[model samples]
Target: MSLREACESGKFVVTAEVAPGKGTDVEHLLKDAAIIKDRVDAINVTDLQSSVMRLGSMAFCHLLTDMGIDPVFQVTCRDRNCLALQSDLLSAWALGIRNVLALTGDHPKLGDHPTARPVFELDSVTLLDVIGKLNSGVDMVGNELKGAPDLFPGAVVNPGADNEAAMDLQIMKMEKKIEAGAKFFQTQGVYDLDAFEKFMKRIEGFKAKVFGGIILLKSVGMARFMNKNVAGVFVPEPLIQEIKDAEDKVQASMNIAVRLVKGMKDLCDGVHMMTLGWESKIPGILDEVGL
Candidate 1:
């Protein structure tokens, strides 16, 4: 079944992300895809995730589709203008790629190539508005399109933002995205269940499907790095202590991920695991959680 159908069925859906390598070698990519293909309802192909230059997300999605895996093509606005974005969306639709996750993308400075020019022709909110217009048989500027795309578009949310008012800001953004034609939302990595619960309480009236984000940390250093460098993501001291005290960082990381998933099972419609480079451990994480 399609990711849309799986999510709308009220089932506890599971999705994972795959970051294509910088080069053309897709051996590890395919292996990771195969590992989670059966366990996840859909797979997200990250578009140059974290501003690190890599293979294109659309090509990765097409490859996943060929492997019989449903892929959510993650489109970022950092590198493309409306014209290019629309052109790629048309290509994705023509190639049978249905699921799309629109993002404003990380600033070029955060990526590997810091000198690259940043493109902010449109933010995510504007992108969603464009998608809605396209669905209605028109482009962003009200130009008529030869055909409309039947895209199951989704958007991102940062549930871990530190500001007391950040949650409200996020909910407001979500409402706008929904009005602009977003059907589902997958959040940034969430480590605090209390924060996430609070965010959900504020948006209980929205009709969009929400999938909590879970990132698997390989070590305490990694967790610390995220806590410090990644905005809108906070790792509680207790989790940090747990990681610091563990004898085996890898096993401890997996244990923490499983616990997070188990705790979030009843709180949200689904979980989107961002395993990063540790994608191989996903099966073990799912097995531990009995998912």
Candidate 2:
């Protein structure tokens, strides 16, 4: 089923991330996509995730669709200006990619190519508004379009933000995205259920589906690195210790994901599993969670 259908059905949905390789070679990525095709409601193709350069999100998304997998093409504002952004949206629709995830993207300074120039002409909120305009059969400047694509747009939120003020800012931004036509949300990595539950309560009235982001922790060191560098991501002390004490780090990570996804079944509509290099482990997690 399509991602939109899965969300509208009110059944617990499952999605996974597929960050394409930096080069043109996609043999490994295609293999990974094939393994998880039947397990997920959709696969999110990241757009230069972390601001590091890679194959274009739109191209990989099309590749996934041709391989009989559903893709939520990620659009980042850091690389494209308004003209390029709108053009890509139309092109994506022509290619039969309807699901989209809008992100402001990471700063270039934080990526591998720090010397590269960054573009922030449009943030995530404005991108949602652009999608809304396109869906209405119009361009950004009010020009009529030949046809409007029925795009199911989504945005990201950071429910696991550290400070109360930062968390409040995230909710306020989420409200704006919803108003701008965000149909769903895929949140930042979630490690604390209590914090996530509180976030859900705060936004209980908003009419949007929430898919908790689950980034499988491979080791205590990995968790620590994210806590130090990644914004709005914190790996609790207990979880870190659990992985540190486990006999098999990979299996421990999978078990941790299964437990978290099971617990989140009642709190959110679905999960956006982000396994990065561990894409092969997603089918195992889904099977164990009985999805």
Candidate 3:
């Protein structure tokens, strides 16, 4: 079944991310794809994730599609204007890649190339509006396209905001995205179920399918690094302490990931696993959670 069907069927869908490397070689990408091919409902190919340049997400998604894997092609506005974005959407549709995730991506400075120029021509919210227009056979400027594209559009949300007001504002944005044309939502890394529950409570009436994001914490040090550097992601103090207290960090990390996935299964429509560089460990996580 397609990711859209799997999500709309009210089943707990499982999706994972695969970052194409900085080079043209797709060996690692295929290896990681093979690891979770059967386990996940679909694979998300990140677009220059973290603003760092790499093999294009469109190319990687096409590669995955050729290998008979369903791929959610992630498109970010950080690198493309509406023209290029719309063109890419049509290209993806022509190639039989249907699932898409729209993001306002991290700023260029946050990535490896610090001196790179930034582009914010259209934020994610406006991007959603653009997609809506395209779906209706119109371009961004209100001109009709020769042939419109039908995309199963999705957007990103962050439930781990530090302040209640900020969290509430994020939910408001999510509602707007759904109104604009978002069929589903894939959230940022969620560590606290209490926060997620609160966020979900506010959007209980909305119709979009929500997939909670779960990052596989590699170690206590990794957790600390993210806490210090990443925005909108918080590793709860207790979970961090548990990792810090473990004698076997690898086993501890795996246990933490499993518990999070199992616990989140009942709370959301699905889980988007961010294994970071540890894609090989996904099977173990799924096995532990009985997924």
Candidate 4:
């Protein structure tokens, strides 16, 4: 089933993501995705994650289509204005891409190119509205189109935010995204299930499907770093200590991933696995999660 169909049908959808390398080398990334083609409903191609420049998500998505794997094209508003955004959206449709994830990308100052300028003319909410207009056969400014793309657009959320005001703002944006035509949402990394369950209760009335994002905790140090640096994602101290205490860190990490996915199955519509470099572990993880 298409990702959209799976989400709308309430099927326990599974998705993974891949970030392209710095150079033109995509063979490893493609190989990684190939292993999970049948296992995941779709694979998300990141758009300049952390504001790092790499191969464009649109091109990588087209490559995925060539491999017969569905791709969730991630588009961010940090680099492009409205015109370029619409143009790229049309370009993506022409390349046989049907799914998109709109994001307000990280600032260039956060990446290798610290001096680069940012163009945040549109945030995630307005970008969703642009997608709605395009889907309705009209441009952002009421211009009509000879053809329109049937894009199933989604957005990002942070249900694990520990801060009250931050969580409230996330809910408000969630509502705006839905009104702007977001069909689904993929959350930030979730390590604490009780907090996530509370978040689900808070969004009980939302009409959009939510996919709980699970990132593999590769090491105790990685967990500590994220907790210290990442704003919304929190890796609980116990889970961090569990990894630190384990002799086989990789296995422990996968175990934690399995636990998180299995725990979230009933609480959310799906799980979006951000496996980082551990794509090889996905099949085994799914097997552990009972598929």
Top lDDT prediction, candidate number: 4
Off by over 4 Å in 2: none
Q: Which lDDT tens digits does candidate 1 get at residues 1-291?
A: 789999879888888999898999998889888977888999999999889999999998999999999999999999998899988988998887999999989998988999999887987888888878887899888999998998889999888777868767877888888888888899999898887888888788888888999998877888899998998988898998988898998898888899889988978888999998777888899999898
Question: Which digits, one per residue and each the tens of the lDDT, describe model 3 over residues 105-215?
Answer: 899988899888778798888888888888899988999899888788899998887787887788788988998889888888988887788778878989899999999
TM-score of 4: 0.99
Q: How accurate is candidate 4 locally (lDDT)?
A: 0.93
**lDDT (C-alpha, whole model) for all candidates:** 0.89, 0.92, 0.88, 0.93
Model 1: residues with Cα > 4 Å off, grouped in runs:
none
Q: Among all windows of ten consecutive residues in candidate 4, which has the lowest summed lDDT?
A: 158-167
Q: How high a TM-score does candidate 3 get?
A: 0.95
Tell me the tens digit of each residue's lDDT in model 4 across 115-172: 8899999999999999999999999999999899989999999887667888889999
Taking the tens digit of each residue's C-alpha lDDT, what string does model 2 give over 1-291?
999999999999899998987899988998999999999999999998888888999999999999888899999999899999999999999998989999999999878899888999999999999999999999999999998988999999999877889988998999999999999999899988888899899999898999999999988889999999999899999999989999998998898899889889989999999998788999889888899
